[model samples]
Target chain A: MRILVLNPNSNPEFSAQMDKAVEPLRFGGAVRIDCISLTGTPLGIETQRDIDAVLDPVCDAIAAKEAEYDAFVVACFADTGVASAREVTSKPVLGICEGGLSAALNAGERFGVISTSNEARNAELRLIRSHALMERCAGMEPVNIPVVEMMHSNELAERMVSAGRRLAAQGAEVVVLGCAGMTRHQALLQDELGIPVLDPVVSTAAMALGAIAGRG
Target chain B: MRILVLNPNSNPEFSAQMDKAVEPLRFGGAVRIDCISLTGTPLGIETQRDIDAVLDPVCDAIAAKEAEYDAFVVACFADTGVASAREVTSKPVLGICEGGLSAALNAGERFGVISTSNEARNAELRLIRSHALMERCAGMEPVNIPVVEMMHSNELAERMVSAGRRLAAQGAEVVVLGCAGMTRHQALLQDELGIPVLDPVVSTAAMALGAIAGRG
Candidate 1:
C-alpha cells in the first residue's frame, strides 16, 4: 500500500520531519510513505481561508492519483480539509488532529491535547467538539511555543515533562503532543508522564493504514 | 447547510424511498438536501466487491461538489466506505452504519444491526471487527429479504417489529435498521420495539449535523 502524506504547510523541513518520523513504517513493510507539501500556502495556518487554500489543490492531487494510493493524509496540527478530501478519495484519508484524537479515545477515557499556539488551541477546541470528544477529553492547553521554536528551545524537554505531569494531575490519562515538530519528544514525554504521549503524524499514519487495508 | 446524500445503489425505488424518509430534516430548518443515486452500480451492495465498485464514483461526486456542499453522505445499507470516508473528510461525511452504531453506543451497552439482505448482514458482521463496534454490539442479523422484495412483503412491518423485540430481549436498548431503504419505518418500529429503532440514514444525518454544527 502506498500512503500519500500531504503537509498543508509549504515547509519542506516539516514534511521531511514527518517522513523521518514515520520511516519505520516503510522499513517495517507497513506501507510506502510519500510526503508532499502544499506549495503555494503560507507556513502557518490559522483560519478558514488557510484551510480552503490548501484543499482544492490537494483534492486535485488525490483525484489525479486516486488509483496510485491506498490512503491519503492531511498532516497538520488542525487537520484542515480532511472531510472534503475524503469526499474525493476512495482510498482512506486522515487528518492528523482527528486521527490522533480518535486513536486517543482507544488509549483511555480522557486525554490531554498539548499544543503550540493559541490558534492551534482554538482549532483543537473546535475539532474536539466536532469529534464528540468533549465528553472524553481531559483538557487542552497551549505550551506557549511555536512549531519551529520547539526545535531550538533549550527548555523544550523540561517544559514538556512539567506540562505533561500537570495535565496528568488535572486528570489526563494520556498527553497528546499537538504538533508534528513535537514528535522528537514523544518517547521522553511518555516516559516522564508514565502515560501515552500521542504524536499526531505517527498515530495518523497508523490510523490511515488501519482504515485503508481493513485493520482496526 | 447543504448535505449531499448519495444512495450508493442503482435502485431508484430505494432512492425515492430514502428521499421521503429524510423529509423531516427539510422542515427542521435551513438545511438543503440532495439525494442522488450512484450512476452505475448493482441494485444492492452486500459484499466487499460491491463496496469497492461503488466507493470511487460515490466519493468522486461528493468531492466534485465539495465547494457547494457543507457535508456529504453515503446512504447505502452497508455503510461500506465509512471508516475510509472518516479518514478523508473534514466536512463531516457520515455513513449510516457508523452513525447508527454510534447512536447505539449512547442508547445501550449492546445493540444489534438488522439488515434486509444476506450480503448486508454479512457486511455488518465484518464491520463489527472493522469499526471496533463489537464491544457495544450484541450481534447482527439479516431479515433475508432483498430491498426489492420489501414492496411485495406485507409482513415487512410485523417481521421487523418481531426482530427488534428479540434483539431487545437479547439486551439491545436500540435497534439499528441497517438498510437505508428501511428508514421509513423508524417510528413504527420504535413504538413497537419499546426502544430506539434507529434509522441509519436519519440518525447519521442527525449525528453529522449535531457533531459539526452543534446539536440544537
Candidate 2:
C-alpha cells in the first residue's frame, strides 16, 4: 500500500525531517510512504493565515495524488486541509494531530503536547476542547522556535527537553510532539522526561497502517 | 446527530441493559441515540458461528436503516460484521469491541478484557494479536457465565469483580467489559477493582458523536 504524506508548507527541509522521522515506522509492512511539501506557502505555517493560504493547494495536491495512494496523511500539526482532503478521498485520510491524540489516548489518560510555538499550542488547545478531550489533556507546551529553524538547530533538543519537563510537571503521563519537525526528538525527550513520547508523523503513519489493515 | 445502536442479537432484555448503560453518556450534546436489537438471531452470540450467522442479517439491517441515522454501532463484543457494515455505508460504523478497545487504550497503558466466557475471551485475544496491540493488552479474564444470564443473575457482579481483580493481578491498569450485556456492572466493577472500567456502548456512543462532529 502506498501512503502519501503531505507536509502542507513550502519548507523542504522540515518535510525531509518529517520523512526521516517516519522512516522507522515502515517496519515489516507492505506500506510505501512518499513525503511531499506543498509549495506556495510560508516557510513555516505559524499562523491561521498560513494554514488558510495552503488549504486549497494541499487539497488540490491530495486530489491529484489520491489515485496513486491507499491512504493520505496531513502531516502538519495544525491539521490544515484535512477535512477537505477527507471529503475528496474514499481512502483513509488522517491528520497528524488527530492520529497523535488518538495514540496518546491509547498510551495514557492525561497527555501533554510539545509544539513549535505558542500559536501552534493554541491551535492544539482548540482541537482538544472541540474533541471534548480537555478533561484528559494535561496541557500544551511550546518550544518557541520557528518550524524551519527546528530542523537545523541544536538548541531544539534542549528546548524540547525543557518543554517536556514542564509538561510532566503538569501531570502529563504521555507527551505528544505537536510538530512534524520535532519528530526526531521523540526518543530523547522520552528518555529525559521518563514518559512515552509520541511523534505526530510516526503516530499518523501507524494509524494509517491500521486503517489500511482494517480495510483489507 | 442521531446514532443507531444495534444490539445484534434478539434479546430485548440485553438490548434494554445496553440502552441503560449508554444513558449516562448522552450528556448535553445534539446526539440522539436509539437502541434496538436485531431480530431472528440467538439471544446471545457466543461463538464464531453465531457471529458469522448474524453478519448478513446485520448488514441487511444496516443497509435498510442507514439513511435514518448519522452513525451506526454494532453493539456486540465480537464486533460482528463491522468491516462489511463500514463498507456498506458512508457514515461512521463502529463495533462495540473496537470502540471499547479504543477507549481502553485511552484510559491506560495496558488494558484487560473481562469477558462472559472463555470463548468470548479467546475471540478478543485473537483480535488484540491481530491488531498488533498484544503488548498493550494485559490479558482477558472470564466471568464463567453465559451472556444471557449475566444481566439477570445476582451473582454476576461478584463474579465480574473477581475477574477484574484477576486481570489487575496480571498487570491490567484498566478493565474493559467484553460484552454489551455487562455494561450495567461498569461503575460497580470500577469501584471494586480500583481501576477505570469501560462500557462498550458508552464508549461507542462518544466515538460516534466525535465522528459526526468531525463530519460537520
Candidate 3:
C-alpha cells in the first residue's frame, strides 16, 4: 500500500522533518509512506488566511493524484481543507489535529495541546470545537516558538517540556504535540512530562494505516 | 480490498443481521466486505468465558487466512481477542468497542453506551476503563433485551431510544450502540433521541477503512 502525507506549506525542511518522524510507522515492507511539500504556500500556516491561501492547490493536488495512492494524510495541525479533501475523493483523508486529538482522548481522560505559537493554539482550539472534543480538553499551551525555529533550535525540548508542565498543571492528563514539525520531540516530551505525548504526524500515519487496514 | 468481519459466535441468523448492517458502508467496487459466523462458540457471547472459549479459534482463523485479507474487524461489542490478534498478525485488527468509543470521543464529550444486557454492560465498561476513557463516559444503560431477541423484535428501536433517554438523564451527550447487531437501529435512535448515536459495527468498519487507508 502507498500513502501520501502532504505538508500544506511549501517548506522542504518541515516536510523532511515530517517524513523522518513517520519512519517508525512504516511497518516493514508491507506499506510505503511518503511526505511532500506543497509549492507556492506560505513558509508557515499561522493564520486563517495562510490556510485559505493553499486549500485550492492542495485539493487540486489530491485530485490530480487520487488514483495513484491508496490514501492521504494532510500534515496540518489546524486540519485545513480536510473536509474539502474528503469531499473531493472517496479515499480516506485525515488531518493532523483530528488524528492527534483522537489519539489523545484514547490515551487519557483530558488532553491539552502544545502548539508552536499562540496563533496555532487558536486554530487548534477552533478545530477541537468543530470536532466537539473541547469538553474533554484541558486547554492549549503555546511553546512560543516559530515553526522554523523548532526545526533547528537547541531549546525546542525545553520549550515543549515547559509548556507540557503548564498543561499538566492545568489538568491535562495527556499531551498532544500540536505541530507536525514537532514530531521528533514526542518521546522526549513524554519522558519530560511523565505523561502520554502524541505526535500528530505519527498518530495520523498510524490512523491512516488503520484506515488502510480497514479497506482490506 | 477484502475485509472480514467475524461475529465470533455460531449463530448464522445473527451473522446475517451483522452482514446486512454494514451494507451502507460498502463503497461500490472499491472494497468487498463479508460477515461470517464462527463455529464452536455460543449463539451469543454473554460472558468472559465465552470470549475465552472463542479466542483461539478466531485467532486461528485470522492467522490461517492472514495472507488473503487486508484487515479484520471483530464484530463483538466485547472486542474479543483484538489485542492478541494484533500480536499474531501485522494487519490492522479493530475491536468495535474501541472504534465506537474513539469515534464517540471525537464526536462529543461525555458519551454513554447502550447495550443489550447487563452482562454486556459490564464488558463494555471494562473495555472503556482499559482504554483510560472511563472519565469521559457518562455510564452504560442496558436495553434489557438479549442479542438474538434484538434481531427479530420490533421493539428494538423503542428499547434503544428508552435506554438512550435514560443515558441522557445520566448526562450522556452522545450514545454508542454497544452491540454490533444493533447497527440497523443507529439512524433511528439518533433521530429519536436528538443526539449522535454510534453503531459499533459501522464505526469500526469506517475506522477499518481509515486504518486501511493509512496502510498506503
User: TM-scores for chain A, candidates in order?
Assistant: 0.90, 0.95, 0.95
Model 1 misplaced stretches (Cα beyond 4 Å): A47-49, B1-216
Regions of candidate 2 where Cα sits further than 4 Å from its true position: A1-216
- What DockQ do you compute for every candidate structure? 0.03, 0.03, 0.11
lDDT of each: 0.68, 0.76, 0.76
* Candidate 3, residue B79: lDDT: 82
B18-125 per-residue lDDT for model 1 (tens digits): 677666554343457778887778777756788888877776767677777766768875665554564455455667666556544534447787777667676677
Docking class of 3: incorrect
- The residue-by-residue lDDT of candidate 1 on A119-206, one tens digit each, is 7788788877765557667877667776657666787788778778777888997677787767777788877776767776766665
> Which regions of candidate 3 are displaced past 4 Å?
B1-98, B101-145, B148-216
Inter-residue clash pairs, candidate 1: A82-B88, A82-B89, A82-B90, A83-B89, A83-B90, A83-B91, A86-B88, A93-B87, A93-B88
lDDT of 3 by residue, B1-216 (tens): 677888898888877877776664554445677888888788888788987898887898889878888779888888888878876787768778877777665444588999888887887778877765686789888888877676777888888888999999999977888876676777778778777677667667655654554334
Q: Return the lDDT, model 2, position A104.
A: 60
i-RMSD per candidate, Å: 16.7, 15.8, 7.8
- Where's the lowest-lDDT run of ten residues in candidate 2 chain A? A207-216
Q: Scoring model 3 with DockQ, what do you get?
A: 0.11
Q: In DockQ, how does model 1 score against the reference complex? A: 0.03
